[model samples]
Target: MVTVPTRVRLGYAVGSFCTANFTTIPGLLLLIYMTNVLAVDPLLAGVVVFLPKAWDLVANTLVGQWSDRTVSRWGPRRPWLLGGAAILPIAFVVMFIGPPLTGVPAALFVGAAFLVAASGYALYEVPYKAMPAEMTHDYHERTSLLQWRMIFIAIGIGMSGILAPILAGDTVEGYRLMGLVFGVILLLAMLASFFGTANAPYTGQAEPEASLKAQLRAARTSKPFMWLLGLSSAQTLGAYVMLAGAPYFAAYTVGSTGATTTLFAALVGPMLVTMPLWVWLAKKLDKRGAMILSGVLFMTGAVAAVATPLFGPLYAHLVIVVVGVGYAGLQLLQFSMLADVIAYDGMVSGKRRGGVFTGLWTAVESAVAAFGATIYGATLAIGGFRESDPANPVTQPQSAEFAVLIGITVVPAAIILLGVLMTFKYDLTSAKMSQVSHDVT
Candidate 1:
């Protein structure tokens, strides 16, 4: 029997914080880097930002499948984790350093570095995500594990969001310093997780003889998994658009770049404070109910945020606080729900195939990010956004504002609403998941 200590669990969560730091910094700052510092056209920058992540759509799934069948003395997942800890940080530093030459040469260098970082992220993230399913078979325990994990995720987001601006100083040096800081923290976190968490013994539960095609076919046929994938992909797009566009809106629309820090603090602060509330809601209403309620709040808040220009900064900030509350619930509960889905798949297939599922999950997430960047980047192009002049009178060109509004509110709200609709298809209630746990064990 494998027992997960509270300390070990906490260590895993902290490790996730480190691993996510690389991605969070990029997600929050990449657009700023391209447009403001590098003088890339906003539209073109968006494309550059969007395309590299799209590569993850393919990479994440392939890495996941490979990890699942891997056999080793240190176990399958940890080796990848250890390896990524070393490689990802170096890639992250190189990404921010930019290329030796100017213009296209620089852009190509940045893109190539980002590709390497994404691969490293997959190396850790797929196995990290899979651990929840493999660690315990209990339904409530899965929720508990995810809840813990999310707390750390919030920490990562908060640190990256709040500190990146402060550390980076100017756009150019700030990105470079932020990369170095995040890379160091990531290494520390991975080492903690490696030393702390004990792997659950493999029970010969994976089908050693199963062909890759056969496993893919099985995953393809899973209806519940498919529905979750659809919902999650849409949600990813919504979240990414907000992340990518918020800084621009803060600087140009609100007339305050500091507002970016304030907004992020409002968003993540609630998540950290009210995690217990979200966990309770999950327990009382169940994951699907909690998700739907959270989605509604997210939609309401997003719509309200879009209207900020008309309402003025104070009112807009208030609306954002409200939205943060909703975001807190949705973000926490979604991963918990994902853990449940993985367990359900395991029960039905009679095989532990977490690597494949996590891989696919991460792939969809990366793809959605890519898609959102495409939309955001193209919107900037269409709107004629110029990044160099923070105070460019042209920054708020009617077309640009329209694009920001669409990216921040209209499109995100629609996507979130779709997520709510899809929640109805998640048939794995806690009770059902509990039953599945019993049978699988």
Candidate 2:
């Protein structure tokens, strides 16, 4: 039996505080800040959102490849964690502070700040995500371990998602303070994870690392890897957009600041409550099936969201709970499945390149999120959503309301439906993964 200490797991899971805070909350708030706070053109702001992602696509892979070859007393991944702990928080803070510029200049400043923040985040996340495959070779144990991590992810999302908007309510200064407070929390969480996993045995990360090119080649050859990447990237387009656009959806469709909170809770509450059910389902149905099931649930909720104007916001939230239930399954299985893919790769490829693969994973995640924000921003720009002014709230055009509807509904539903079809062809199964785990361990 491959068992890990609960202490180590908690320590590692704590890192999700930083990851969730950085990914979820900012993803929700940033584009709005650009359009509303600085009065940037929505389409141009989307371009700013996209620039850092382009960098991460290249940067995360390089960082992951470098970390794999690192030789240090603390081991390969841990040292990067500490560096990330320092850099990401500082970068995060900079991204939110309003520099005394507007239009293209303001866009340029935010784009630069976000690029640095994304780079620091990738440094921490890629190696952290890769750690699961190295720490446990047990097929089910990895799932168990990741369930705990998902719990931390939930906590971070709930706390950050609620706090950020409340703290930054209708003002630039408020956002700055929100950034500072969350920056401190993020720093603390990263340190806990770095120190917490001090005693974890490094099983999969053997020395004599492969060249970056060879590692890339192996990841390319893994069908399971490619499938997960495509499925996740496609679905995340909807997921990130829903998260990023929820405020707009609530404000325009539901007509209350509180509605955004309700939306957040509807998603997070069910996700927290039903995670165990999803984990168990993964055990019974396998990751691929679970993901497809999740996709269906997500599509159903998104389609329901399209009719927000007809149903009261209360009913919309009820439907969101359904989406949340499915999101839990997708969230857990995708992560656990990736760990399985890496383990499988280690078995057949004769090398451990977990960092490189995970780096690529973060790269894809970053890209999709960036694309989500940009696509939504462009759509809103087309729909005539007014640039935000905290001093005097701009009345959005009728088309902008429909744009939020599309971002939260139509575009995402189509993409998720496509991703669900892709899952049908995914060949990795629990039985195959179990054999891989047994052979390796």
Candidate 3:
């Protein structure tokens, strides 16, 4: 019954620039930056990427709990959003400022900057994710708001995915400029959200839980939330594996680094155009059905891409467009479902615990995303990937090229298919939500 204002929706959606840019750029390029630019071993590069984000397991939960208890004029969430806006950009810029060293030293420097950046990212993301449930109780309105968010996410992913590579080139200096450019973008987007939601409405804010353990205990009891978490974690992992392998797929598998931008463009273009169609489909199929269809599409693309060696770059780009279509739906529905679970919790339990649920959601999402990079890195290691720098470019072994193809294709396809199967466990239909609303109201 509640309809969010268009200005508020747009304000909230703009924050996706921060979320999408931070996650996509690193997942898409950081591993390559280490292996190809810094001359770090593939396995070591993966570890460096993984360890910093692993910290999110702790930081996100704490931030969530902290924000839940926060008493601020800016509201519980916006203060942290402001903090993250200021800090993350600086840390992000530092992440790719390009250390004057290589190997372990370079890895350590980048790792430290990333750890700070991860902390800053958690500051914003946990509370930001918690907002929609608090914003409105209407299920469809949440989806509407998130539709706007996904559009921005698509734009953010598209711009960064397409341009960051071009900006970073294959050299250290290029990466430095890319970092500065995106950092400013991150700052402006996050601040816009903080100010844009200045007059946003809140449906309700319940009393905070006694402790983090108690909050999480309450969250664990929600079957819908649990199932959603499992489903999203698996989906994120599979997607990021493909993302991590993208550069290698461009260079070695497609025989040109320029393909990275084109590949990402293919993957993001559909996300921009088809979001409304997916949202409409969800009305007919229900969110769960739409989710399954989207997963199938993603799996189909990934499976088809395995034959890229036979079909070549044009085929690779075409299939990636399929993956992009599915991905748009997946990204929109996952958080929309999370908002449903959070709203349901407030109704059933009489407490505002969105932060706890979102913290867990973000922690798992961040970790698994990083883990995807590690998985691809391990695959590259298995194929005996040779690390090199711009000064001394080296030809990759055929085995490494094979690893790139399989890592980007079969591994992701299989993992995403399993996620699709897990969707059956999610039983939070609109009918169920309508019944819950009737009972609560």
Best by lDDT: 3
Query: What lDDT tens digits, residue by residue, belong to model 2 across residues 162-244?
Result: 87888887677888898898989989999999999998766675553468888888788889999888988888887887887
TM-score of every model versus the real structure: 0.93, 0.97, 0.99
lDDT of 1 by residue, 116-166 (tens): 888888888888787777776666776777677778888888888788767
Residue clash pairs of candidate 3:
none
Give me the runs in candidate 3 sitting further than 4 Å from their true place.
none
Give the distance in Å from residue 333's predicted Cα in candidate 2 to where it truly belongs.
0.9
**For residues 174-279, what per-residue lDDT tens digits would candidate 3 score against the true structure?**
9999999999999999999999998888885688887999999987888999999999988999999999999999988888999999999999999999999988
Error of 1 at 336 (Å): 1.6
Q: Which ranking of candidates, highest lDDT first?
A: 3, 2, 1
Give all candidate RMSDs, comma-separated: 2.4, 1.4, 0.8
Better of 1 and 3 by lDDT: 3
The Cα error of candidate 1 at residue 46, in Å, is 1.8
